[model samples]
Target: MILREQLITQGVSEKLLDDVEKFKAFYALTDQNLTSRVPQTETVFYGKDIWAMCISALLEEENILLSGPKATGKNVLADNICELFGRPQWNTSFHVNTDSASLIGTDTFIDNEVKLRRGSVYECAIHGGFGVFDEINMAKNDALVVLHSALDYRKIIDVPGYEKIGLHEATRFIGTMNYEYAGTKELNEALVSRFMTIDIPQIKEETLMVILKNNFADANEEMLSQFAGVFLDLQAKSRNSEISTKSVDLRGIIGSLKTIRRGLKPMLAVDMGVIGKSFDQYEKEIVLDVIRTRIRESWEAEDIFPER
Candidate 1:
């Protein structure tokens, strides 16, 4: 509901909002057990244009792929979309080991009888939940081949040796992949063709401020700006090839701010959240310099958060 209002503040149209409401109403979840799967987000995705585009695509029943560098808020937006539509989310984290059995289903013995153990995608399709495929490119093409029928015009999952199931009308699959992450590879043409790809851009400082305000309301505005600057400076360095995007992390900044709220020193909190991400000593030094330049070595929690 907060994201709906924020979307309005960001100039997303009333029509799109109305459509999302209608979507929620039409595909209402009756499974009480799935209530917990509907995510409650700590942060919101802030781009009105991106929001509108995603709303439009989902309205037309298109599966979308969010393609971008790290920290572009792919998972955040996917989570927000699930929240907006009031859909339960089933998050499938792809890795080298991800395969058909892990995604669809596998058989297991219970009570001396072999029964099908439902997988995330299987459950997601049957319940009309939003399925978020994270780092999809990391999985082998053959592994994801099981999803072809489910994602295409057929809209069905045909499990071998079991009954084929139709995807619930409200079901939408959202895939996200980073541009340059370890153990990731190109998505094969067949897999890529199924998605309406949305290229996510880097977060702007203004948007970053709004996110910070949303998550850390007690934090001072100047301190929030400084935190935002830390990310942006790292982003600038990344763009110029001075450093990899590994240290230019939005989540790290948010986590650092959270640790600061818990009375950790600014530099140490950033060290854990941002600087520690890069294992390379040279990279860590660069990240440290970028962060220390924005936030002094001696800044305290009181400097960032005001009295409650």
Candidate 2:
């Protein structure tokens, strides 16, 4: 099913969809130039309740802050939300060095004349696009002070040498952060208050199996279950502080399946995708042990799936 149909079936209120359509129609009547920034994503976000909550927040014009641990589908849901609303997306990955000039814009000399180079936030604000502030807590609080006005009721971007620009009515900002990640700072209360925060939970075993089946259609149910089990086992280890999260990657599991499909040995493919992610020898050994416990070294494509 298409994204919109999936959303409606997944419990997003009909009114919310109507509101989004109305918002789009209103923008169509205006002369504002809006560039298409929608992302082409293959991942689907499950859980009807979470979909409803996100739709409710956007319809109310509230900025959303998604906080969770790594690989909990945070970025996936952000991209999915943009698709569901049919709005242009401007993804700005925040880091320690991301400054106000990067969020807003900077004056640059071009063609013998000084012109303002609009940044992600600036363009999103004016064009009614969704701005994704990825890993927001990675940046220092002082650097993010400029966002206070834009996020708050003021909804205005104050450029030092330029006129203030009001954000479009349809403009919304979504901030994502992995709270447990190293080097991430606690978001100050002032900045936190401006957004409606949601704590994204880890993907459930059933959901993980669904995702794995969707991606690895050629794999049998038992093998898919084993892959999901391995991921959950690694997740449990990380949660218990037995190892760092560097080795627990959902994407890596899918990557391994793809490599195996290409006729590579299953163990070697899993090693390249899952174990190879960690640079530390100790970490690699730990990850390899998990794989060993899950799949035997003698296992081949026939062991995981029916021969096509």
Candidate 3:
């Protein structure tokens, strides 16, 4: 209680301060109390501090952008942020058809009268919660226009027929995207100017191995290293345009390693990890070749396989 008051004294707005109070109370009473649950200590995530800083900035009502390739732990990073901050999160995935009504609020005809139903952004803002806008670049420019007002100095949303609502001080939006990919437009200067962008690097081999060990305690360490190496190799191929971006999946590797530990054959595990990622026959073959070559090399180094 005193801390909340102190936050208000430190220039946090009244609405946000009050919302935080409500959040604290809810946690104390609700069966699913978020505050009581401890954050994960066993799963090691490298560059985790960058996400913490981003969350801190959000607590101060600053906007942020996270740019990274697929399976770089972007969503996990977001989840950890909410867990650490003790805030509820609302997720809004952007696509070509996303519009103002989708972000700001929409009035629906009910009982012959239109009533405003808050969108994810609106609900998160008013409730002093965090919002994650996933794949923000996938949205059309017109769809993002509503955010300019919400994010900028105005810090308010005005629905013509309804009340003008100011943002709660703790309300923050985290936008995630993979900027290097095709079909993603450069974030317009106006929108780009509003955010503090953090470039998330691809997960390193050591970090990936740590994740595997934590997730699969029974797996051979050498085999886990091979799995990580395969993903890194695929990532390099993607970067070089030798293969499409979808070829690499760190999550898939972990899942397949778990399968391998459960007595699945190496080829079967590799298929589980690499084959399903592709929809095209050609892409699948390429991924399979890469996986076989890498895993074979790793196995031979341990004298477990005979070289051709």
Candidate 4:
């Protein structure tokens, strides 16, 4: 992999390249060096603009927080940024139980003596990797207080019992959250001020179709288009408040198409792909009717077996 400086020279943003270089140098002296960078992420045409903007901010003095509903590709985008910058990714999936001790390293007993074992965030920061805070809003706000100083202008981390360390110039945190969903809280102002928030809206039908066309080379184009229509129908229902589900993920539809192409019963594919995982029972029943009606009418013409 080329160094961050090389990537910049190759027409990538100077700011982003510099951040990558900083990460490499910072991690080189730490025990948690990833030893390599992320592979070049295949960028989706639909997200290029947003991705570039986010990368530019990350390179300068800002972090990014991606806000969206489920399946909006938040995590995927974060991973892609790390790849584009040739930086290793350190993913930390946040949950209610996550604590500062979990974000930074903790002292634990080893050989009857205390030894420091680095947490996901700390190790990644020291090693110059991108730290992806997945589903960050699910974590208790108090747990993230430790990150305030690290993320802001201070740009340093103080580990009281161990050492006060400064952040690696390359280290940046990209947090992902689904704020519209239940149980998610407002990102605290203190934390919010530190990041450049990018609101990830529902993906376009054309973009989703492109993803399916590219991902499944053998998939029939007609079927792919039909699937995209089905996804939009579901999304429309959600927006109109006629459905309780928040979104119909294009990736799920693609997976369903793959299953059907592999000879799984189409209804069974819809059941696993579109149903059984979202909304409450009444709403789910409504969605099931929609899926069955659409798949049966559209695919049965292709001799795809209908649901019993």
Candidate 5:
């Protein structure tokens, strides 16, 4: 109810909300064991339009590919989608070593005979869970071949030596990719064609403020503004190629604030959470320069959450 009301407050369409409610009831989970797969997400995605787009696409059974740079909340939105719709989620991060067996099933010896140990994708498919393919572009092209059948219109899994099975009606897949990451490539045309792409954008300052306030109601308002300013400055610089995306991190900012509430110095927490994210000493210096423009090195917990 809170999630739905939050969406309504954000100006999500009533018609869409109605459909979402219906969709939730219509495909309600029957298998209680899968309840653990439902994400316990703390952050609600803030974009009205993005929420509507993802809801509509998923309601129509289309696969989603969230494409963009870091800190854009692609994975967050994916989690919000699955949580709002009451679906179990299976997340897999792609890498060079990822292969068909890792996604489908591998042969295992059981009861003195060989049996298949189901993988994340297979579990998601058979049980109508949401498959979150993180770093989809990082995997070698050959490693992703196993997903082709399930991703396209076919929506079937043909596991060798196992019975072919159709995806559960409630099954949905959401893939996230960062285009310029090392060892990553643009998704192939064939793979791209299977998904309805959503290009996530950086969080607006106002949106970031709302997220911050929601997470830290007791934090000083002025301090919140300064932290938000720091993030916005980094985001703008990163966008303009003045700085790398390594330091334009919304998650890092939030995490650092949490540590600040736990009695760490405000600037030092930012250093570990935000600045230290980039291992390159030169990049760290550059990010610290941006942060110091907003956060004072002498700031402490009393300066941020003085009421405590």
Candidate 6:
């Protein structure tokens, strides 16, 4: 089944699903070409409660703010929400350099005439698309102030030197923030108040195993469990301040499994995906020790997956 159907089957209220479909049908009637803006995602968000909260917020026309640690599937849920609602998605990765000009439109000289170059936020607002503001706290408070009006009840964007534009009724913003990450600033109260915040919990062991099995169908249960154990171990260490979060990478584990499927040694594949991501020698050694404790040297592709 498609994502929308899956969401409904997964217990998203039928009423909410009807509303989303109506909105999508109305959007289609407008002739807005938003196919290119839709995000294609392979990952499925598994939490029923989280999905329910997100769907309810979007149905109520409230902006969503997902706060969590790394690998909690924030981006995945954001993408899934847009897919479920049949809305186009605009991903804006915020960093230290992000500013109001970057979120809104800017004037540029095109063919000797000043033309307005619309940014992701501007386009998403006007087209009634889902705007995913990733790592929002990474940007300075002043830079994020531009979103206040758009996120609030007003739903308006006052672009400098341009006509005041009201956001499309279907427009919604999903902001994600990792408060524990280094160099990320605390979100200002005003901005925080504008969003209906949800604290995303780390994926449970059962869910992680499911994700692994789904992604690496060729791998055996033993190897998948081992990888999940290693991931949880790293997460525990990171939580206790024994290690940096650099080693707690869900994507790295999946990438390593793929490499193993390609006939590379398990250790080498793990190193390339997990250990090699850290540049610091000490950090690498710490991660390598963690892996060594979980993965034995004698393991091979055949050991991890007998069918392979």
Name the best candidate (by lDDT): 1
Candidate 6 structure quality by residue, lDDT tens digits, 1-308: 67777777667677777877887777763444687667778878877788889888888899999999887889989998888778899999999999998999788999999888999999999989999999999999999888899999889998877887899998999999999898899899999999999999877788899789878888888878998888888888888987888888888898899888888888988988898888889878888888999898888877787777
Error of 2 at 81 (Å): 1.2
Please report, in order, the local distance difference test score of every candidate based on alpha carbons: 0.90, 0.85, 0.70, 0.73, 0.88, 0.87
By how many angstroms RMSD does model 3 differ from the true structure? 7.8
lDDT for model 4, please: 0.73
Q: Mind giving the per-residue lDDT tens digits that candidate 2 earns over 1-308?
A: 78777778667778777887776666653333443467658888777777777878988899999988777788999999887676788999999999999999999999999889999999999888899999999998998999999999999999988899999988999999999788999899999999999888877787888788877788888887888877888888888988788778887888888877777778988888788888999878887888888888998876666663
Q: All candidates' TM-scores?
A: 0.92, 0.90, 0.77, 0.82, 0.93, 0.90
Q: List the residue pairs that clash in candidate 3.
A: none
lDDT of 3 by residue, 1-308 (tens): 23334334334456654554565454432335433432333333445356445645665567888888877777766665555456668888988889989888898988999998889889877766668899999888877977888888798887778988998766677789987667887778899788888888877776677677667655556666777788888888888988887768887887676566555666777776777878889888888888876676233222221121
Error of 1 at 26 (Å): 1.2
Question: Model 1 Cα displacement at 284 (Å)?
Answer: 3.2
Q: Candidate 6: misplaced stretches above 4 Å?
A: 8-15, 29-32, 109-115, 278-286
Off by over 4 Å in 1: 109-115
Deviation from native of the Cα of residue 168 in model 4, angstroms: 1.6
Between which residue pairs do clashes occur in model 1? Answer: none
Q: On residues 1-308, what C-alpha lDDT tens digit does candidate 1 reach at each position?
A: 58788789889999999989999998887778887899988677888888988999999999999998887789989999999999999999999999999999999999998878999999999999999999999998999999999999999999888899999998999999996887898799998899899999888878788888888989999888988998999989989998887888888998999999999998899989999888989988898888877899888888998773
Taking the tens digit of each residue's C-alpha lDDT, what string does model 5 give over 1-308? 47888899999998998998898898898777888778877778888988888889988889999988777788888888888889999999998889999999899999999999999999999999999999999888887877899998889999978889899988999999988678997678888899999988778978889989988999999889999998889888888887788877888999999999999999889988888888888878888888888988888888999876
- Between which residue pairs do clashes occur in model 6? none
**Candidate 4 C-alpha lDDT tens digits along 1-308:** 33333344334567555665675454453333453546455433245556567867876758899987777778767876776566678888888899999999889999999987889888877776788999899888998999998898888888887777788777888999997666676678898888999988878876677677766656556666767777888988888888866337666786777688777766778777888667688888878777765677334323432231
- Off-target runs (Cα >4 Å) in candidate 4 are 1-45, 110-113, 278-281, 297-308
Backbone clashes for every candidate come to 0, 0, 0, 2, 0, 0
